[model samples]
Target chain A: MEIVIVSLLNGLVYGMLLFMLASGLTLIFSMMGVLNFAHASVWMLGAYFAYEVSRFIGFLPALIIAPLLCAAVGAAIEVWGLRRVHHNGHVAELLFTFGLVFIIQRSVQMIWGMLPMPYRVPAALDFPLFTIYGANFPAYRGFMLFISALMLLAIWLMLKKTRIGLIIQGALTHPNMVSSLGHNVPLVFTTVFAGGCGLAGLAGVIGGNYLVTESSMADAMGPIVFVVVVFGGLGSLGGCFIASILMGMIQTFAVVIDASIGDVLKPIGIALSSETLLGEILTVPMARIGPLLPYLLMVFILLFRPRGLMGTRDT
Target chain B: MSTTLRAGAMPAPRSSLVGPIFRIFLIFALCMALPWLFYNYTTGRHSGFMLTMFSQMGMMAIFALSYNMLMGQAGLLSFGHAVFFGLGGYFCIHLLTAAGGGSLPVPLEILPLIAGLCSMLVAIVFGYMATRQRATAFAMITMGIGELVATAAVMFHAFFGGEGGVSSDRMIDRSLFGLTYSQGVQVYYLIVAWSFISILAMLYLTTTPLGRMANACRDNYERAQFMGYDPKFVRFIQFALSGLFAGIAGGLSAITYEIVTFDSVSGALSANALLMVFIGGTNAFGGPILGAVLITLMQSGVSLISNSWLVYVGVLFIGMVTFAPAGLAGLIAMHSPLQQAGRLKPLIVPYIRIVVPGLVTLIGFVGVVELLSFKTIGAAQGKKLVLFGNPIDATTAQPWLIVTGMFLLGGLWLWREGRWFHTLWEAMMADLKPKKGAAQ
Candidate 1:
C-alpha cells in the first residue's frame, strides 16, 4: 500500500514533467504540422543553459534566463533553418530538425564533455514536503508540481483571455484567413515556435535536476514524448495531458510489479519453461520489461486508434 | 505520320533496354575489376581493407536502393526499415550455423535468397499493419515498431543472442562454385554478383506496372483510387519487395562480417539508411547507389581522420535538405540540359568562381569543427592537432580567429558568386528553352 502511494506520487511528478515537454511539442506540431524531432534536443540545451547560468548567477534567475535563451535559439532556427526548408515540404522540415538532433547532441558533448552535469535541487527545496504513507515526498517535487500547475494555468489564460492567443488559435485552423486579416502570420509562427521551445526549456530547467543532465538525455526522453503525443492524439492538449499522466503511471507502476505472465497463468495449471521464446517472454518479470511497455502500448494504440485517444485531427 | 509514330514506338523499347543493359554490364565489369585494381602485387594478395570496403559498398548499395523503393518510389518514409535487414541477418546467421552443423544442406550461395524470402514474410505481416496509415502516421507506427523490435532483441536472448549477438562461419563447405569459401576474394565476388543481380532486379521493378502505380499513389492517392487501384495494396507490395532486398543486403552483411548484432536493427542503422538515400538523391533511380558508395567511403575513410565525422554528415544532410533537396544526383542532372544545348562552355568560368569560394568555406568550417573537437575529445585522448603536417595548439586563439575570418569572408564571397552564377544559369536556361521550342 505504501509502495503504491509512493509510486502514485512519483508518477504524478513525472507526469507533470512529461506534460511540460508534451504541451510545447503538441502546440508546435498542431500549428505547423511538422513534428520537431529536435524538440528534445532543445530541452537538453535548456538544461545545459540553466546549469551554466545557475553556476554563476543562481537557480532562480537561471530559470527565467534559460528558457529565454532557448526561445532565442528556437527563433533563430525558425527564421534561418526551418523557414528556408518550409518551401520544400513537411518531410524536408522534419529531416532538417532530425539532422539538427545530431548536430545539437555533438555540440553539447563538445561543450559540456560526455558526462552528466551535477545540477541539483535548490537547498530550500531539498527537504521533505510531506510523507506519502512511509515515503518522504521531496519539496523539489512539490516545487515542480507547483510550477507546472502555474504554467498550465498561464497557458490556459493566455490562450483564452489574450488577443495574441486568439490570433494563434485562429491561425491554428485558418492560417490563410488569419494572414489575409493583416495579422503577421509568419511572426506569429515564430512566436509559437519560440514559445513552444521556451516551454521545453522550462521543463529542462526543472526536470534536469530531477533527472540527469547529460548529452544522451534527449535521446532517452525523445521517443517517450512522441509516444505521449501520439497516444493522446494530435491537436489535443487535454488528451496530451491525460496521456502523459497515464504513461507516467504505467512506467512508474511497471517498475514495481514483479509478477510475470507465468505467475498469472500458473493458477490455471499452466506450467511454463524458460527454454522456448514464448516461455521466456511469459516468464520474464514486468519490472524487467518496464522499458518496453510504453512502446508496446504506443504500437497497440497506433494500430487500433490511429487518431489517438482524443485526437481532433487525422494523424 | 503513322509510320513515323510506329517507328518511334518500336525503337523506344530496344533503345531503352540497350542503355540499362550497357550500364549494368559496365557496372558489373567495374565491380569485377575493383579488387584487381587494388591488388598489391608486391604482397601477392588483394588489399584486405580495400576488399572489405568494396564489399561493404555493394551490400549498402542494395540496402540503400531497397530503402529508396519505399522513400523515393513509394513515398513511404520508414524509420524502422532496418528491422527487416537485421532480422534477415539474424536468420541468415542461424541458417549458416545450421548448414555448418550439417542440419541444413543448403549452400551459402542461395542463403541470401532464403533470407530475403524470410524478410518478405515478416514484411507482409508488419506491412499489413503499417500500410493502413499513410504519411506521418505511417512514419510513427514504423518508429514504434522499430523501437519495440530493438528492445525485444535485447530482451529475447534466444533468437537475438543478447548483447554478444549471433555469429557463424561463412565456410559452410557447401559451395556450388567448386571453390573453397575461405578466401576473401571469393566472398567479394559473391557479393558483387548478388549486388549486380539485386540492382538489376530493383531497376526492373521501376519499369513494372506495380512500380508505376506505387508512384501514382505516392503523388496522389485519391487519383490512384479513382483509377480503381487500392493505394494500400500497392504500398504493401512495395514495402514487402523492399524488405526482400533489404534482407538480402542483411544476409550479405551477415556472411561478410560473420556476425549479427542488435545494432543492425537499431535506430542508428535506420537513420544511416535515411542519410544514404537522402544524400544520394531520391528523385533519381541511381541516387541511392551513389549515396551508398559515398557514405561507405566516408564511413571507412573520413571516420579514421575525424572524431566529429557525424557532425559533418549531419551538416551535409541539413545542407542537402535545405539547398540541394535533389541531392548529388539532382545537382549532376541539372547540368545535362546545358550540355545538350551546346552552351555549357560559358558557365565554366562562373562555376570555377563558385567552386573556389565553396571549397574555401568548406575548409574554414571543417577547421572550426576540428579545432573545437580537438579541444574537447582530442584533448582528452591526448592527441595533438595536426594540420598540413604541422602540430598546432588548439588552446591558442590565433587558429580560431583565422578559421572564423575565413568562414565569414568565404561565405560572403560564395553568396555573391552564387547569385551571379544563378543569374547566368537562368539566362542560359532561358536561351536554351526558346531554341528547343523552335527545334521542336
Candidate 2:
C-alpha cells in the first residue's frame, strides 16, 4: 500500500511533465498540421538555457526568462524557417523540423560539450515535503506538482475565458473565417507556436533537474512525448492529459510490479524457461520490460483506435 | 503561396549521344574501377578505405532507393524503414553462422536473397498493420513499431545478441564461385554486383503497372480509389517490396562488415534513409542513387575532418526543404529543357556568378562551425584548431570576427547573385515555354 501511494504520486509528477511537453506538440499539430519533431529539442534548449541562467542569476528568474527565450526562438522559427517551408507541404515542414533536431543537438553539443549539466532542485525546495509510510516525498516533487497544476489551470483559463482564447479557438476550426474577420491568422499561428514552445520550456525548467540535464535528454523524452500525444488523441487537450497520466502510471507501476508472464502462467500449469526467446519474454519481469510497455500500448491503441481515445478526426 | 511544380512532370532531356543502357554500364564500370583507381603502389593492394567507402555507398544506394519506393513513388513517409534493414542483416548473420558451421547448405552468395525474403515476411506482417492508416497515422504507427523492435532488440538476447550485437565470418567455405571471399576488395565486388542488380530491378519496377498505380495513388488518392484500386493494398505491396530491397541492402552490409548491431535497426539509420532519399531527390528514379553516394562520401570523408559534420548535413537538409524541395536531382532536371533548346550557353555566366558566391558562403559557414566545434569538442579532445596547416587560437576574437564577417558578407553577395540568376533562368524558361506549347 505504501509502495502504491508513493508510486501514484511519482506517476502523477511524471504524467504532468509529459503533459507539459505533449500539450505543446498537440497544439502545434492541431494548428499547423505539422508535427514539430524538434519540440523536444526546444524543451532541451529551455533546460540548457535555464541551467545557464540559474548558474548566475538563480532559478526564480530562470523560470521566467528561459521560457521567454524559448518563446522568442519559437517565434523566429515560425517566421523564418517554418513559414518558408510552408509552401512545400506538411511533409516538408515536418522534415524541416526533423532537420532542426540534428542541428539543435549538434549545436548543443558544440556549445556545452558532451557532458550532462549540473542543474539541480532549488535549495528552498530541497527539504522533504511529507512522509508516506517510510518514503519521504521530496519538496521538489511537490513544487513540480504545484507548478504543473498551476500551468494546467492557466492554460485552461486562457483557452476558455479570454477573448484571444475565443479567437484562437475560432481560428482552429475556421481559419478562413477568422482571417476574414480581421484577425491576423498568421500572427495567431506565431503566438500559438510560441506559446506552445514556452510551455515546453517551462516544463524543462523544472523537469530538467527532476530528471537528468544531459545532451541525450531530448532524445530520451522525445518519442515518449509523441506516444503520449498520439495515444491521447490529436487536437484534444483533455485526452492528452488523460493519456499522459495513464502512460505515467504504467511506466511507474510497471517498474515496481516485479512479476512476469511466468508467474501468471504457472497457475495454469505452464512452466517457462529463460533460454529461448519466447521463454525469456515470458520469464522476464515486468520491471525489465517496463520501457517496452508504453510503445506496446501505443501500437495497440493505434491499431484499435486510430482516432485515439478522444480524437475528433481520423489521424 | 508560390505554385508548386512537380518534378516528375518535367521533360526528360534528349540524350542521343548516351543511351540509358550505356549510362548504366558506364556508371557500373566507374564503380568497378573505383578500388583500382585508389590503389597504393607501395602497399601492393587496393586502398581499404576506398573499398569500404564504395561498398557502403553501394549498400546505401539500395537502401535509399528502396526508401524512395515509399516516399517518392507511393507518398508514404516511413520512420521505421530501418527495422526491415536491420532484421535482414541480423538474419543474414545468423545464416552466415549456420553456413560457417556447415549445417546450412546455402552458399554465401544467396544469403542476401534469403535475408531479403525474411525481411519481406516481416514487412508483410508489419505493413498490414501500418497500411491500415494513411498519412500521419501511418508514420506514427511505423515509428511505434520501430521503437518496439529496437527496444526488443536490446532486451531479447536470442536474436539481436544484445549490445555486443551479432557477428559472423564471411568466409563460410560454401561458395558458388571458386574464390575465397576473404578480402575487402572481394566484398566490394560482391556489393557492386548486388547494387547493380538491385538498382536495375528498382528502375525496372518504376515502369511496371504496380509502380504506375502507386504513383497515381500518391498524386490522387481519391482518383485512384475511383479507378477501383485499393490504395491500402498498393501501399502494403510497395512497403513489402521496399522492405525486401532494404533487407537485401542490410544483408550486403552484414557481408561487408561481418557484423550487425542495434544501430542498423535504430531510428537514426531510418532517418539516414530519409536523408538520403530526400537529399537525392524523391521525384527522379536516379535521385536516391546520387543521394546515397553523396551522403556516404560526407559520412566517411567530411566526418573525418570535422566533428560537426552532422550539423552541416542538417543545415543542408533544411535548406533543401525550404528552397529546393525537388532536391539535387530535381534541380538538375530543371535544366533539361534549357539544354534541349540549346539555350544553356546564356546562363553559364550567371551560373558561374552564383557558384562563386555559393562557394564563398559555404567556406565561411564551414569556418564558423569548425571554430565553434573546436572551442568546445576540440578543446575537450585536446586537439588544436587547425585550418590549412595554420594553428589558430580559438580563445582569440580575431578568428571569430573574420569568419563571421566572411559569413555575413558572403551571404549577402550570394543572396544578390541568386536573385539575378533566378530572374535570368526564369526568363529563359519563359522563352522556352511558348515554343514547347507550339510544338505540342
lDDT of each: 0.90, 0.90
Could you tell me which residue pairs clash in candidate 2?
Answer: none
| Tens digit of per-residue lDDT, candidate 2, span B108-193 | 88999899999999999999999888899999999999999999888888888998999989998788886579999988988898
Q: Score the docking of each candidate (DockQ).
A: 0.74, 0.85
Count clashing residue pairs per candidate: 0, 0
What local lDDT score does residue B61 receive in model 1, on the 0 to 100 scale? 96
Candidate 2's C-alpha runs over 4 A off are: A180-182, B1-19
Q: Model 2 in CAPRI terms: which quality?
A: high
Return the top candidate by DockQ: 2
Judge candidate 1 at residue B235 and give its lDDT: 93
Docking class of 1: medium
